[model samples]
Target: MSGLQPLGSVDICLVTMPFVDLCRPSIALGLLKSALKSSPYRVSVSYGNLLFAEKVGVERYGLQKFGRQTRLAGDWVFAQAAFPEHVTDTSDFAQQIAQDIRRLAGLDRDPETLNRLAELVLDLRDQATAFVDEMVESVLAQTPRIVACTSVFQQHTASLALLRKLKERDPELITIIGGANCTGVMGVANIESFPWIDVIFSGEADDQFAPLIDHLMRSGLAGLDAACLEGVITKTSAIQLRDVSGKDLPCAFVSDLVTSPQPDYEDYFTTLRQVSYRDQIVPGIPLESSRGCWWGHKCGCTFCGLNGHNMRYRAKRADQVLNEIRSLRQTYGIERIEFVDNILDMGFFDDLLPRLANEPRKFNIFFETKANLTRTQVGRLKAAGVGWIQPGIEALHDQMLKLMNKGTTNAINLQLLKYACEFGLRVIWHVLYRLPGEEDAWHGESAKLVPLLHHLMPPTNFVPVTVQRFSAYHDDPEKYGLKLQVAPGYLDIYPLDVERIGQLAYFFDSNLDYPSAHDRHDGFLALNKAIRDWKRAFANEDAPPILGMRDEGESIFILDTRACATERRFRLEGIQADVLRCCDPALRSERLAPVLAEHHGRRYTESAIAQAVEALRERRLLVEVSGKLLQLAVPGEIPDLPARSTFPGGIDAPPNLAALIGASAKTAVAA
Candidate 1:
């Protein structure tokens, strides 16, 4: 294009149906620059892909707390409500969300409900399309000689469809697809399935993409025979197609893609005036220090998709990582950033974090890691300004955890929780349910696991598990025999399995097994039973709005609500009633005061606040608190209350209420 030894390659667009906006663009940029070194083309790299928040509700409209799962549920419901004929797992999730939105909005076929639903659906589709279109146009404007796309989840389908339209307009454009979802699942997605797609590549895209782009730019067209591509599934005829292997594909090409000329972040994002997220765009370039995970433990837990139980870690040079961070900051104006790594192993942290902290950039990073990290590592994370850490804890029950191949024990999980709690770091423990073994554990032995989780609740959590073919049980069902049954919907085997098997297994696709009446009946019964048990025990209870001490701790009180000690007992002789008030808004002063008063006599003093807090603390009825501000802490059951004795200001006047005496007077005097 300009200022380079050009082989006539004008632009290269690297795309992914993104799971997160971090690192991919930067990583792609780095790789693209490396690829250009071998080419005679004037190379320019631009990234655009459909970036999705697991929950569409929050990403599209601004319901920040609305989780990806909840949004998925809402979307599933909307999709079903809109097109029930295409029922799938997504539909069921959507139905649940629809029910919830119905309840939350209090709309029963009313105009308000319909309008809200309509607006939400439109907003979802529009925002999703807009983002997809924006990235596509941005790339198209670069006049790329090559186009590559990747998908990680189902949402990418919409974005891929848009890309196909672009392809239809310009068939000569070289198109390649690769990512977690695309590489593994779609071998050679039927070219007809996506008419705009010229070639669907899988496995690792780094080595494959550069070579293909070079070939396409040099020859103006490249041949795609099944053997040349490791994993390509292409339609050769109206009735038949070919499936090729992609196992031999080279590993990701990790190198500096952009050279001497640095990026201008303001210019880049500013080009798209409406950046997707409205929150403060803490300008931090996303980059990964490594590829794959290092948790070599054989049993990573059954539900884990991270690394597919194959832990591979290739660390980037520490100095290079530090240099990149500094470069992105100085050149691109990035300050706060997130390091999107599977897990920043403790060793990496010990070396990298201290160096990073010394580098003079105040950055805020986000990461998801295993629970086996040490307290020291967590402390490092907090010190590094990591505001969010998604730890994969999966389940509290050992059996369930084993079933998921989560190698760590509940004890280890709890220890991590304790450290995070003590350190006051915001953490979200990712949990899962409905694993294959859950049914066996559900009857009795496993029931205990739920309460165990009570001890380690986090501010954010989730529990979801879907049956899959490659899980230990699914992989070797002959051992379990009749005890293990495959669900119909799970036929869409993960690409990891396809890599092993070479051909698509009928057993993995959801539609195949459920074809017959009896098979479908048995499979569905198993799923439904799991769902029922999960709902009864976990359901929305594990969801967030993290509980605090103020949430009623029943069992101790006469009415089985929050326990209340009588005010008479609490009132030391001649103590004023107004001195004990502690302004904990979490407490329902009106309702709880009478209960507290019935327990502690009408008395006023700072000691009364201390006594009430102390009493509740002793009984374990209150949540763990810091200073005067209280948080609901205890997970279950309040202790027994001592028999009540009558006191003044109604039999149920709070002992601390007396402490309130002249509290307003003090406030007035201060004013």
Candidate 2:
């Protein structure tokens, strides 16, 4: 919790570079730091991201970090500094990226907007060298014998730039790189491409990092035999580590997450205090209760490549999770906890949520989960202080959901959304399209369905699906009737051959020829427009779209203010009210009829129940998906949930970079 120890007191300095979110620490570095607590080496973490944000202005830094993924703008900017000889000219690169952005984002080619984007890209690209130089000097000041960098997302090029400079400054200083980007073939590619990188760690280095450090301290890099190090990939051992097919051997994962040390985030907090815009930032502590996707283990989503080589599910005990949360809160005096798990452990619903609900102190939590959550489970999540969730609601059509292998139908996805709205939980989700074998009609149907649910939260964005390595589509593109190639943007970012780039690339651009491929454009446009309107409806703080219901003994009152509402209010009684109550958790027509019959002690035919459901659907009170009917109107008063905008220093929107820089300058002058 104290400031970073004096220079020359640190041995292994783990670095987290630019473009990573400054609102949280690098859990990878934090875990490795704690893993080395008992080792002879004195481990320290250098939050280069905080330092770089201070120098370049946080707003501009965020623009690149949270910007369009396909653009790889952050990587391109730092590629200039990292690979100067390769990426010499930017006139063509800038023009190409600008055009790609317009096409992908469906933005009109407005000259001024495009010119401003170009200017920002070039300006940031120009500043990369100086920032990398400053970071190198800062890291060298610590006099660390071994410097390691965690590279994920846009951090790859920046990490390379810093380590390259450090190696140039001190050739004896060991430079190591590892993270999501450096797994399997990507790790081998990095080792082969960058001569400065002395070692590359693939896979989960949780169990291997500390031991590797111990080996280096005792034996150094000379004549080092790394066969015992499970995930270590060095230049000499890189070839030997590959299989007969020349593919790099899969890295071993930690089977038992219980034994892993709780991450040490002291460095993140210490670095945060030194940030010039510290007051503007509300930091959240990142914790992991589980690793790998349990759903993926059974039936992996076709478009997902998040788990890399390891899709086997592993989770710590419920007690371990609770203890970690309490310890982090007590240590940092912060209550916002973000779970970095790919998916919530199903056991947590029965084990962890109940414990958190019973706790005296409440913590705001964010979790990613499946969309099949029942209403009771949703209520439990709300009670457990899980205010935000990414429930993987990727599609709103049954056929589309099947294509993605989501294992949940459109009805279940809608039910989750309705429940989330009713419980005042912020749902972080998006509509993903462009799956192989997708029909144009699916998009049209989704666009039609969007307006009826304006009372619920809109998706964050509508994104075109991209093929990623380790995904079903990428692993067997031919089987899906698609051809995969390196994402075109990578050509502009990395000046490498297509084949070599393919090996290094995580995201791939797919080429599929379907009969309705061209016609699907209009359908996508309509859906995107509908989603945009849904988001706009929530913009006015004074009045938000609302469709809510209150249940009385004899009557149910439904208030409707949604854009698609037919009337201001409606009163349901007798069979209508009973049908609404019966379908609160969603039910098939046959089941609805039986339930309604049991409620009133009278026989109700399926046709009669269907007619009543249709009447409610006409008034936008009920929705039937995949033959199951669900009540759309949320029960009781809807709470005013906190919006993402309310969160301090979120990376979603761009602030004024010049203002941040000017403010920091004034602060330094005052000091």
Model 1 TM-score, all chains together: 0.59
293-376 in candidate 1: lDDT tens per residue?
A: 666444444434443323566666667666777876666554545566777656668787777666555565566778877767
TM-score for candidate 2, please give it. Answer: 0.93
Candidate 1: segments with Cα more than 4 A from true spot: 1-10, 15-115, 122-142, 190-192, 223-284, 308-310, 357-362, 439-459, 467-671
- Model 2 misplaced stretches (Cα beyond 4 Å): 1-8, 95-110, 242-248, 513-520, 605-607, 645-653, 657-671
In model 2, how large is the Cα lDDT of residue 215?
Answer: 77
Instruction: Give model 2's clash tally.
Output: 0
Please give the distance, in angstroms, between residue 218's alpha carbon in candidate 1 and its true position after superposition.
0.3
TM-score of each: 0.59, 0.93
In model 2, how large is the Cα lDDT of residue 598? 74
Q: What is the lDDT of candidate 2?
A: 0.82
Lowest lDDT 10-mer window, candidate 2? 645-654
* lDDT for each residue of candidate 2 in 1-671, tens digit (9 for 90 to 100): 12334335689999998778888888999999999998877888988888777776667676564356766777887887888888455866666555655455455676644555556567677888788997787788878899999999878899999999999999999999999888888888788878999999988989988888987877779755534688788898777754523233656599999998899999888888876778767788889999999999998999999878579999999999999999988998988888999999988999999999999998888899999998889999999989899999999899999999999988898889889988989998999887899987788789999898888888987888888888999888888988888877678767678887887888887775332445547676778788889888976578888989999968999899988999989899877888898887778877877776777664666777777888888997888887888888889888887677533223333555445435544654686
Worst 10 residues of 1 by lDDT: 646-655
RMSD of 1: 16.3
